[model samples]
Each structure stands twice: as C-alpha cells, then as structure tokens.
Target: MELRSMRYFVAVAEAGTVSEAVKRVHVTQPALSRQIRLLERELRVTLFDRREGRLELSAAGRGFLPVVRDVLHRADAATAAAESLAAGRLVHLTIAASPTTLTDVVAPFLATFGPQDPLPTVQESSGPEALDRLRRGADLAIVSQQPPALWSTRTLAVLPLWAYVPRDHPWAGHETVDLDELAGQPLVVLDPTFRPRQLLDQALAEGGQALADPVECGNAQVAQALAAAGRGIAVVSDDPRFDLHGLRITQPGGDHLSITLHAAWDPGHHAAASLSALAERLEIFCRTRYPHP
Candidate 1:
C-alpha cells in the first residue's frame, strides 16, 4: 500500500469519521473515502467498520496502526538523513551537558560554527545522566563521568579547577594553591551540582580536608562576585569573572585538580560519523581555549 494511503487510513481511524478526517487531511470527503477504500483493498482486509454514519477501527486496523506509524516515522527520519548528507554537514543536533559545561565550553564552541554547520540544541544534564540524554533524543552528550562501554566516547578536555580571588587577596599572586591550603581558607563554593564542586568535594574527602565556614552559591558568576567582594576564594572551573585572578588548585601529590570532559554519542546513530567529527572538533577547541601549563 502507498504511504499516503496508510496515512489516510490512520487519519480516519484516529478522527473516527471521514468528515473529521477530511478536515485534518485537507481533502474532500469523497477523495478521502476513496483513498481509504483503496488502502483496504490493497491490504486485502477491512480496516474500519462503518455504521450509523460513524467510522470505527476494525481488529486488523488496530493491529496495523502501530506498524504504519513506525514506517512513517522511519521514512521521515530517512528523508532528514538524506537532506543532511546533501548539505555536507549535520543539519541539526542536540547536545547534553552540565549547566557549567554548557556555559563555559559548549556554548563558546558552538559560537564558532559557520552558517552551514549544524545548529545545536542544548539540554542541561550532569555526570552519567548526560549519557541518558541520548536515549531521550539528544544527539550528543558531554559528561565528566566515563560513559558506558557501548557508547562512542572521546575525551574533550581536562580543565583545571581554580581558586579565584580578587587581585589584592594574599593568594592572588600565587600561581597555585594546595587543596589543603584552600581548605583552611574562607571559601566561596558553587553548589554540588557543578562538576567543579563535585570534583572538589571528592578531592577534599580523599585528602581528609574540611573547609571552615564557606559561602555557598548556585551560580559561578555569583561565586566569583562573592570572591571579588572578599568573601573568600571561589573554587570553580568557570572562566575568571569580575576581574578576579585564578590560581590552579593543587593536591599535595603535586597534581592539579581538574575535571575531564568526555563527549559521548550512540554508536548506532545514523549520523555517527558527523557526531564523532564534531566531538573531535570540540576537543581541539578545548585544547586551544584552555591550554594547560
């Protein structure tokens, strides 16, 4: 049966009458009725029971509806894929990442896209939840956690968490601050939802370090503002704001504290190559944007 006929059958089945279906399908009642009859003939089964000027789905029609819907959905997807191929790039994509990653990295990387590049939609997600976004229709996910074995993943960047302070602060002239040292100072920290904060928490727990009374805030910019106002050192990975100086946070083991960003996508995606290419590009962007000493 023709796809158009299948659509008409579904429309009639859903609308419960040819007259109502005609309004939806934008065809005359006779034309729609003829299409439905043609569809039933091609299928060699009655799709609808017509009685008392009403249309109701027959047993076969009910069984066929889901199959036809699946076919139509696949057909539309194929058309989109073909169009994207013709454009020589992805036409659109959706990326999932934490709010900080979205703000500090993905948002800036997206700004470099040319006119013909795929337009990206962003969803706020964190950690393992970012990978779950793929199942929810996100084309790509950027997460700090290692993705599942089945997913195609690339390391995008390893960005340092910094101890930010106003220029006049005592530690402002220092190139780095030990986690233990930072722990002993008055602190300005973003909430645990932020990746930097999560990493910081883990590092502190590992070192058995605890902060004295610290200021907690939700926004990175606001955290920097508090630090600029001399509340404490802002411990975050966000780009320096409010003219604050940032010192690389260090562990006693002589390692800088950092968060590693990974880009992940389903291997079975139709545009898997495009997604991988985009991930590689993001990696390169991050390397340049946040160079490590």
Candidate 2:
C-alpha cells in the first residue's frame, strides 16, 4: 500500500520474523504486524505465514517480494538521482567497460536512460582498462572481466562473466568450452594493462593453456570487428553486440572463463551507503536483462 509499508514488508521478509523486522525498522512488533495486516487486507491476500516462530513467505508472498524489492529499489534510485541533481557534486560512478564493450555494450546500456536525464554526476570509465578508477576511489567499478575480486571493499558484488563473440567463430555452436581450446588461436583481448588480462591468464593457467600472442584492442566494438577481420577471437559480454558477418563465436566446451563484475565500496567512506544502493540498482538492472545465476 504505502511506500513505508512495502519497506516494512521487505524488512520482515529479509529478517524472517516479525520481531526482527520490528527491531530492524525500529518499530514495535504489534505495530509492524498491524501494518502487515493492513497490507494483506488491501491486497486481499496474506503475504506471510508463521511457522515455529519464523516467518516464511506464502506462495503469494514469494511472488510479491521481487515486486516489492523492485519498487523499493526504484524509490531509492529516484532519491539518489534527486540528491545527485541537487548537489551537482560529480557523484562519480566509474563504470569500467571492455574497450569494444564501451561502444557496443556499456554505452548502449547506459543510453537506455536519456542522455541528459538525472545526468548522474558520472565519469564513464571502461572496464578491464579502467580498473584504476576503482583503485583510486571511483564510486562504481565494473569488475566482471577482471580478476576474482580486484578491490577489497566493505560492500562488493561479483557477477559471473560472459563471453560474446561472433556467430561464425569455431566455438559458436557449443554452449561452453574448455579454456585450453582457445590456446594457439588468434586472441583479440583487452590490453595487457587491463584487469581482464588477469582473469584471462588465470583461466588459461588453470586449464594448462594460454593464448598464443594475444592482440589488444580499445573497446568491445573494435574487438568484435577485429575478431571478424580474422585478427583473433574477441572475448566480451552479452551486452556487447558481436553479430558481425563472417565470424562465429563458440563457448568453450567444458572449462569456461567466468569473469567477476564487481561494484564495491570502502567502509570508511561517508557515501558508502549511497554507493551500496547504487551498486544494487546497477546489478539488478544487469540481472533483469541477463538473468544469469
């Protein structure tokens, strides 16, 4: 019903008990229960059922939680966007994209929102190449194509990496691949200085193989073009388009390279809470479209 009611409901679901939710929301258990009751009455359905003093979402509640989370998340983003607009303080979100991905993937992803809307005091940083931004206090970083975890922060979320290549590449038909199969193939990779190199190296080493003379490029668009040009195979994500003609992309058969995309924040920073909220929104945005585990 009310925004605060939804918030309280979410708290109860997360805490797994009305008493704990009361403690978390800083309200009395009776009052929290009353609000929940009101919400159920308005919706014409009960959201939770108590079992052994623990609260569990009923079937309806299970379906409802994500909607509630999405609403709360959007509210949080709206508030952050408003504050960002007022402060005009360059609340920098340094999102690192792979070179080709910058033009082909990340740029397009960011474009879903109006170019001028909320204008998120941002500095678009490319991943793999832009890992430094994270090291030097950039508020948001893309770490999926990089090592397991590039920075140690109070809050960090790592997403599984994906490899998007042309449809004609040798491995295009298979669902996955063994890392060694990529050895000796022409490899179009992020520059050696980029964070993706670490992930690449680790994946290959574990499989006892390595790329033979990798050629580096600037962004996701260029990488795919390069791969299509027969320069080498370009590794990228689903967001980046790799549909160039005359090339095929194949996921390795068994072993695969799964990069971790991380959005993190140091605990000491004053805006850590804000950054964490932003991270959650970005991740949810990525998840809704990609839906990977």
True lDDT of residue 267, candidate 2: 46
- Per-residue alpha-carbon lDDT of model 2 for 173-246, expressed as tens digits? 66554455555667777665555566677666766777777887756567767776778767644344546332
TM-scores of the models, in the order given: 0.72, 0.50
Q: What lDDT would each prediction earn against the true structure?
A: 0.87, 0.61
- Alpha-carbon RMSD to native, per candidate: 8.6, 17.0
Q: 1-293 in candidate 1: lDDT tens per residue?
A: 68888778878988999999998889999999999988888889998998899998899989998888777656655765897878876898889998889999999999999987888889998777888777656789999878888999999899898899899888778999888878988899988777788888889989886666789999888999999998889998889999999999889789999988899998977789999999999999999999876
**Error in Å for residue 109 of model 2:** 5.9
Off by over 4 Å in 2: 1-118, 124-138, 144-166, 238-255, 266-271
Q: What is the lDDT of residue 117 in candidate 2?
A: 35
